[model samples]
Target chain A: MGKSIESILKKYDNCSRDSLISLLQEIQENEGFLSEEAIVKTGKKLKIPTSKIYGVATFYNQFRFEPTGKYHVMVCRGTACHVLGSLTVLQELEKVLKIKAGQTTRDGLFSIEVVACMGACGLAPVININGSFYANVTAESIKEIIESYRKKEE
Target chain B: MSIQIEVNGKKLEAFEGETILTALKRNGIRVPTLCHMNDFIPSGACRLCVVEIVGNPRLVSSCSFPVSDGMKILTNSPRVIESRKTIIELLLSNHPDDCLYCIRNNNCELQSLAKEYHVIERRIHGNKNSFKLDHSSTSIVRDPEKCILCGRCVRVCEETIGVSAIEYINRGSKTLIGTTMQKGLNTSSCVNCGQCIMVCPTGALTEKNQTHMVQDALQQKDKTLVVQYAPSISVSIAEEFGMAPGTDINGLLNAALRKMGFKYVFDTTFGADLTIMEEASELIQRITEGKTLPMFTSCCPAWVKYIEEFAPDFIDNLSTCKSPQQMTGAVIKSYFAEQSNLKPEDIISVSIMPCTAKKFEMQRETMGRNGVKDVDIAITTRELIELIHLHGIDMKTIQPEITDSPMGVRSSAGKIFGATGGVMEAALRTAYKKITGEELVDFKINAVRGFEGRKEAKIKINDDLEVGVAVISGLGNVRALLDEIRNGKNDVHFIEVMTCPGGCVAGGGQRIGVDRSFIEARTKSLYDIDDRETIKVSHKNPEIIELYDNYFGHPLSHKSHELLHTCYMERDVLL
Candidate 1:
């Protein structure tokens, strides 16, 4: 509702085929993820086929095809976080939300995303949900954190 | 200017800026390649074309390596052969071992390569891929597990057809070709031209098998099964029987259909003649009224769908006449049913076409009347061959038989609809006579006849009406013309667009592994018939005249409009 895909596309010059990635990025930034409609709309704007746009988007791991839930959970899978048992925490988070990494919950209240590093090695097994960090998180501790978000959404 | 290059110790002249593969090909040397499509930029993804260069320490892919002056290369060096063998072995490592059950078992390029390279054992075993087959499209099927990821289908879809309905989805080993959003092809921008199936090196792409439904229909005692083969099938089907390419077996086909229990065997050329009558009249009406100046021929279903999806603005410019296949189906359901005193539901109308798009076309919601489809099933030329083989009919021993009366007689102009630029030539023949009120001095308009993608000509219908015409084959050649029309370029009066390059003679559903000479031969067979036939124009066809006398009063009559023409609407796709 913030801006129609057509309105967002009107900002870009149509001639440049090189702007496809940046245009998709901008749309994903606005809409939280690249919707099928957004990809098709962007393809029409750039005179490129949607299959090609999706191909380019899928080549990069950064792009997501699904929208983020209201509470976006980021589980750091950095070198420090991995050594500190963040994998267990991530597994627990996925179990609690009943969704895999990079997937939103069925109710759209919670989503889980795997990140490389949060640049906070001291916080080792870091779990951030909606910008609120739960540092030194354990597998048991992640469940309570997810419960708190679901309760807060209610 | 030419450059000298040494191959296998023999010096040869090569064109400047030509690839090593091109030079070698000119010198009658063959190097194996997987991803090298003709007239397309080589991707060099498959290293099977690797050759040993004298100066370079590493083997280079001959398909991408540019030929230079005094370049020496050994195409079949022991090391080069070993490298190619290893590449094939590695490809087969993860490939499914169900070649016996595959549709393209004997004709498969990968299997042929494996045999050629002596890949006798599972040299490098890897986890087999288990991707699901995509059977969403009515015309085409996608089996990703059998795909070698050659990218020929992707390139042909994007480059040749101008509809990038499929593309590379992911990166590296995980990369696979898929439609937008990994959804099925039905939701994608595929026009169902089946050009992808033509370029696919393996059994990954094939026409949807409708032969089973045909077999089922043949068994029904109460149903009257009528089969119509397109104009191109007569010339193209001979190749499937090990006969010479472009061998006209139209009479033999009628005999075979009858042998297979088909009650009536009608020629689609008669429908082509009917299309010309209606389409020529529509063009004349549009020209006289000065509306829809350049009437686009809607004979190609893939081209019609492409306009409906990608270029909807030109929908108004498209002639309202249905293609010969549908026109034949409609007439068979209505007029033929009435004549035979058979109910429309009791008649099962099947079509044998040199196209995959006809399968999708017959299923269109608008192609039927009161929920009874005009055409019950559409099969490709390949499927017809299968049916012939399945019935164990001896083609060589079969005697020639004549087609049924009334709807089977066709002019040579109608027969030429199989070739590119044929619709334009046929339409111009009738349009000239309609506009000038005189038979054309020479029925053949050579200007529009060719294998070229685009052909343009200006003809003097009369002093005041010198109409411009353009004949285009592939959809790739249409963008510039469409842009011209959008920019108010009004020189052209009629445009004929066939989705497949070189028209239905080289259609997507024709025999695979065929070369350009076969297409040329098939095209020449049609022209050869036209050269000797007395009835050169569609209007001169006795059956078409009799049809107007009996059923519809004339071309563009209300009854004709109801059955012989249809409307197009804008279609939204994932693109």
Candidate 2:
């Protein structure tokens, strides 16, 4: 284990209902995803019902219940990206990866997620493979993008 | 202080901090709302209660809007009605169109509202939710496709029961009132108290339909079907038959069950007397040995489950006696089986209770650990009504008959087990006799009998031994009392807990949409039955006395312990 949840939780001594959002955010940052164990630990420390903590956590798009794959692909659905048919791009990526939105490939190589307002709206029809952005992407170029990653890994 | 407000062109006196809906209803004006439930904080998620306020340009929800001095409000103006109609139409566009086959059917609030607004044509045919029904819970079912995102069930589960087993998983339109990780309710820490089903305005939540199983059982020729109904059913079942709320119909029910092909239609009250016999002895043993100081009554399955889930430390403190329903089942299988010349497996024991948790309770491994199942099936008061109607048995014209011998006769103390604090009252009546070798001068213990959340009494068991006792109804009220004892701030000797607010009288499986007055009426009928009875205490019941002399030998004997008492397990709350 990288670090026990107890060690991470000790950084912030404020275990109140008011600290729920921030506590969840910090735990997610440390663990890369909000695990069930983390959620339960946070619930106990904050003295809040886990259901209520879930209510607060699920309201925001920032939280992820599952960890990301080794190679993450984020499809931008910003206003400009939507105007440029980024939804088709997401569908093409999902079809090729054999996974839906917010899912990782079974082999643990690739994952796909849809994000709103990805900040690079100028680069419409965007699919950021890992940290590298592939902008103005077409459905024809989708296989080439994954093949490039697979070849690099080899 | 009263604030004057104009509602529907009429002047109304609004209490200072009351909502606009309250003020309007006080003035005989009605506004439709689905998410709002009495005794819970108003959830303004449903836009049906939107009303036109003169100063504000937008339509505001009357349920959460506070009444101010000289506020002009119109509940059913053209614009407001149009807004409400649009909201219902939008909700209809997404809701499943299976109202005919829906469990709620004509009783559905959404259906009634749609009829009121004439939402015949779809304005917005949006993508409908296709959430699979959660049939994992033994007592309750969750159908997210029919859910209107009201959050009443979520609130009641969290606020009243103190078990937040379900919650909002996703946000906005994609939101689902479900367990964490979208797991089945069985995996979650749901105690199977069907209060969620009671508050749900739609058919999205309901009891797991055991009616079909019951019908099949009735049709089966091989099994000897032994049926028993809880004490509360006498006062409760009449309401389902379109009779008055508090009419005691035990005699009629006994006759009807027999006519419906039940071989033995027994009263569960006899088991309640057996519970008192064992529970009182256990309390005396614990008091003498000073092991588990304050014994929590285990008569309410939901309360027992609550302790098992949240407060596992106090599991030993809980009285090991099975609930009267399960106790009756055990006796039927073990004791009654040998007497009736039938094997335990041949007898199909069915319990009719005013609790949804009883369904889950019967299925516990502990209940069936003694080789024979205590109860084969447990159905709510609602299911009993369904069976009665299904058989077309006219309850009114039916000739009243007495219950069978041996497992039939019960004292009034046992009869009162339906209401809150009834178990404590019955136990106190017997415990007093056990402590001091004399029958109580006054049989009635009024201190532990009521609709209040918590009640306390100090019994004088002679000058040297004064015992403190408390009775709690709701699980929310239990935390404070338990905390007191845990912190060593309270010296209470015995505690009584009935999970649903007013015990099994207002149990999760009782009739939905019950008012406070109806609960009081049912509770009064129980007390009246106790007063009218020749024998008021559990120990004094002749059948129970004969049972001890014949079968178990004495109270808390090895056989009584094997048949009556049970153990609790610590459950994972987060799972």
Candidate 3:
């Protein structure tokens, strides 16, 4: 993890501070979360303050400052998703997980977020858990998908 | 000869060798398009009119691509729909989604096409590129982010006006339409005609609005909001209220303005007559003194702005007289203020004009000779309709009423100021009498009147005095005339130039979504107004002559020149 952060910092060493968010996003996509060393090194390399870097990391919903759960659920709140009761499906998942959106259970098995329109207009309520699409979801379908993920985690 | 073209598996007979797009349109098949103009050659940059042609292997741009014999065109096929959807998706990806907030949200062709194509989301993940807004010019704005890079505006500027001021700068994703050398429109050779704004499909090019300022004035109880209407506005503004083109709604317009909470509703024609008096006197003075020969009319703001930017050498030739609209503002602030017993600063003067350039013209430093900006805010004819609608004034229900006394009334010479060659005709009507001291037999100068690009006439001002007059409409025609003058090929004693194609009636800030029939109707209505007016000649306008002699001494007098005329400034800022 330390070596990976060092390589990410090296890749974005010459990038300007204005493009730090885009660079950090690219780094987070590979490393999953921004480590302390990665944040400090990014600040040093981009000539940005460490506090400012950490502030930006926490500001955007896409940036994960800490370690994420084993299963990452992104429920689309796009125009299509909202029209097809995606909010209700999200509520069901939160109730079952004993946590809210963008939170994981005490066991650290799940994390979720609502994203913008994902270009699936006809296929509404598209939920992606661990990079797999589950379209036209209801409360029951969401429960089933979360149960399968929980079983796999176990 | 008929050409067989198959659309959606149905065979239709089209004109032999006509564009596939035109053929489809003729057969009641509507394919989305943005850059296709009936007047110009097809550019086919929009890619909305893409049709899947069998045996051709690839999608063809129907606008530019001609219909071959036995052309199998599959429009709205699954492949074609998918291709169109992809194009729309790409457009939507970078386009700003603030539809409700946008000025042209409902009127925009792009928004309508997006809704028709069912483009709900952007699948591609690309960073949104930000660009700065350009509001340097008073007439038009350049919002780069809203620009789709369809090249319609660029083509219209080059093909229609022949002013290649705006062009595509840079390349790839960073490409933008701008003036050469990235100069502000004021510094560039842009004529401020606003043909580019008229052709733009999106909210990329728009008129600078002073609606908020008018709204503020309306709310102020202490300030009296006095509004004046330009001659061209009455002819075209009816279209905004859904009335038939060329519907003479001057009476209805007066009633509507009164209903909109205006204290005094005046006519700009009165000021136009005043303009004729001053301009004709200036021309005669220049000719007699042999200084600044071939004096140009300074009525059109776009023409004035064009001269200020491109041809600074011809500044001396421009008549040192304010436009009728500006003259009305100055008169209202000073002359009308004293007559009505009101403070010039307290009386808020607003002008309704069929011009976007008038908004910029009012802001010029020289326009504040009346101790304040002559015109506080200038709203386009379309914006006046918007205000009327906002105030719940139904134009159809409003009873026809005549304009108020004095400034509200105007002569036939003032009424004709809306059309091409109007200024030259108006000036000649007065200048001939001033030179020969006799009323001419022919009231209408047939030579200077018409839709021709450039017109010239040699009228005998009595037996000894023969004055050569040239009338140029549209900025492109003006450029040619100026080139001829520079090359010493063209020599005329008097000249008139209107930046718009058909003068103020077809101005940039006129009503949108109009057909050719509507334009004809509006033009006929304008002429009808001129024919019906009792006072035909500018010299016979009793109110204007009374105002000049009783208040300001006479035309071309030191006070009249100081208050009603202004010099041009050589602008260097880029648009």
Candidate 4:
């Protein structure tokens, strides 16, 4: 819907349907998240149905439909994190942020997303907020992390 | 190349590139399958078709596994049986336990497979999925709890209907088939074709039942119940009555409707004839006047809705004639009611169609007059059969009866409106006469008479004018043709598009578990009637002629336009 999205689509002019994912990735990379208009436009560019585009986008957790909040929180649910009881920490983050994974809070200040892996598996129960990593996070530490983010926002 | 394969220790001949399922089917060996649809690419999503192969440790899904020379397959060995039973049990683990009251109770493929495999008790217990029932669409009801996630509906919607209104959303354990943005189907690009319902293996999809409304109307003493059945219903409804496929029980159907307390019964074929009168004349006018060149037939509601939403650019090209069902409903409330000395408001006009989309079409904004719908309700062929059963009218014992007088007569041309290419053939019959001032020597146009995805024929009217026509069924086949038309391919003058393959005879509202042969039989029956009948063109029907003479002066006349035609607009959807 934006001029940047249009420029990204222009690069894939006359491209076959096989270029759909890369095209979608480029749009999402520039737009932060895919909008309904973006998906519809991508479908038109790729000669695919919007329902199929949505299906593909929803299948991959990397593609989010909503824009990120001011403080984007990423909770790792990787294999190592799961074994280290990060599920409680993820739930605690969701509760503290008042939003589910891949959703933003109503205040537009905090958002939560769960990642498969952060590649820092050594930090088992890891939580990343705005590119800064918090290692070995517990349910109690989730509130403190949120409180620090709220203080920064204030 | 032909190759030898051993099935259950017996040697048999099979094609080199053929699947093991095909090889086994050719040898008359039955293997239970769920995710496999005939003539469709096998996804092997459901492993129920797994069979044992000698010297192979892993069991292979015969539907997707290609047969090779010296391949020894055991279709029903102990291991294969156990694997199939386990698959059915696992599918039932998360499935709802309401098969007794489900719409597809006995006809469901999943329930049949479970019974065949003898899945007595739940071997694997899991939490039942809690999916909200989607009753958002006027034509279809989606119950996700009963969905087996076999992806047949998803495939049929995409590959067959070419309207991927739904797809598998999310990944792994969270995956479920849904429309765009996880919204209801009403907001999606769904055309309400109901082909997904035909392919759904479980009770996940069914027509929105309207039998209760028909019953309620029957009980109303003040309502004058007037009914009309589509051309395909007589031939297709016989299968539900234990009669042979393609059986012509038109007289019996009329008698049953009358027995069910209907004040009058009519045939929508009469309306089909009326449609041909208007449609063919509209085509001739368009061609001569140099208006829209490739005029698309607007008989199939699903096709109409598809063009409205998916191909809005072609909205002007669509013939403005109301479909045979809607035309009949309009005529019933106006002309027929007037003839019977009744008011339109007192008439409860109902239509029986071989389509679920008609249920949606009846509710369209333009399909009514003065806030009174042309049709009070539209029931499918299946619902009509149910109503007969509910009224305790024995179809076998009921005497064959004729339709109500004055407006009930139909020619064989109208009767053939059930099959693919039927509208084209019917319209051509009358259009030929109207143009050349003489009847066609050979009424049957063989070029447009088959089950091909697309059929094209150039009809010669005079020395200078040759009208090219195209007939295609299944919405999937229209995309390429539409693209070509957009690219300025100007040969085709008229196009008849039916949403379901093989047309209304094999519509979504017809019986389940029917194959291509059944459809062929129904089509053959319609053709057989056309061959035997004297009145084979819509213009020859005395009733239609009389209607024009008495009320509507001519085809596309001012009065006719007010009742028999409507306009379409660009319908907005999520893409």
TM-score on alpha carbons, each prediction: 0.95, 0.97, 0.74, 0.96
Residues B138-243 of candidate 4 have per-residue lDDT tens digits of 9999888888889999999888888899988889777788888888898898888888888888889989999999999999999799999999999997877789
Model 3 per-residue lDDT tens digits across residues B389-441: 78899887779988876687688888889888888887888888888888767
Residue-level lDDT of model 3, residues A1-154, one tens digit each, is: 3347677667766678988987788778877777666765776688654444654565556766556678888889888889889889888988988876656667878887767877876779898877888889999988888888778866
Candidates 2 and 3 compared: the better one by TM-score is: 2
Ranking by DockQ: 1, 4, 2, 3
lDDT measured at residue B65 in model 1 versus the true structure, 0 to 100:
87
Q: Which ranges in model 4 have alpha carbons more than 4 Å from their true place?
A: A1-3, A95-98, A147-154
Ranking by TM-score: 2, 4, 1, 3
lDDT of 2 by residue, B32-82 (tens): 998887766787998789999998999999999999999999888999999
- Angstrom error of the Cα, residue B227, model 2: value is 0.6
How far residue B240's Cα lies from its native spot in candidate 2, in Å, is 2.0
**Interface RMSD in angstroms for candidate 2:** 1.8
Candidate order by lDDT, highest to lowest? 1, 4, 2, 3
List, for all models, the DockQ compared with the true complex. 0.85, 0.63, 0.01, 0.80
On a 0 to 100 scale, what is the lDDT of residue B159 in model 1?
Answer: 86
C-alpha lDDT (0 to 100) for residue A127 of candidate 3: 83
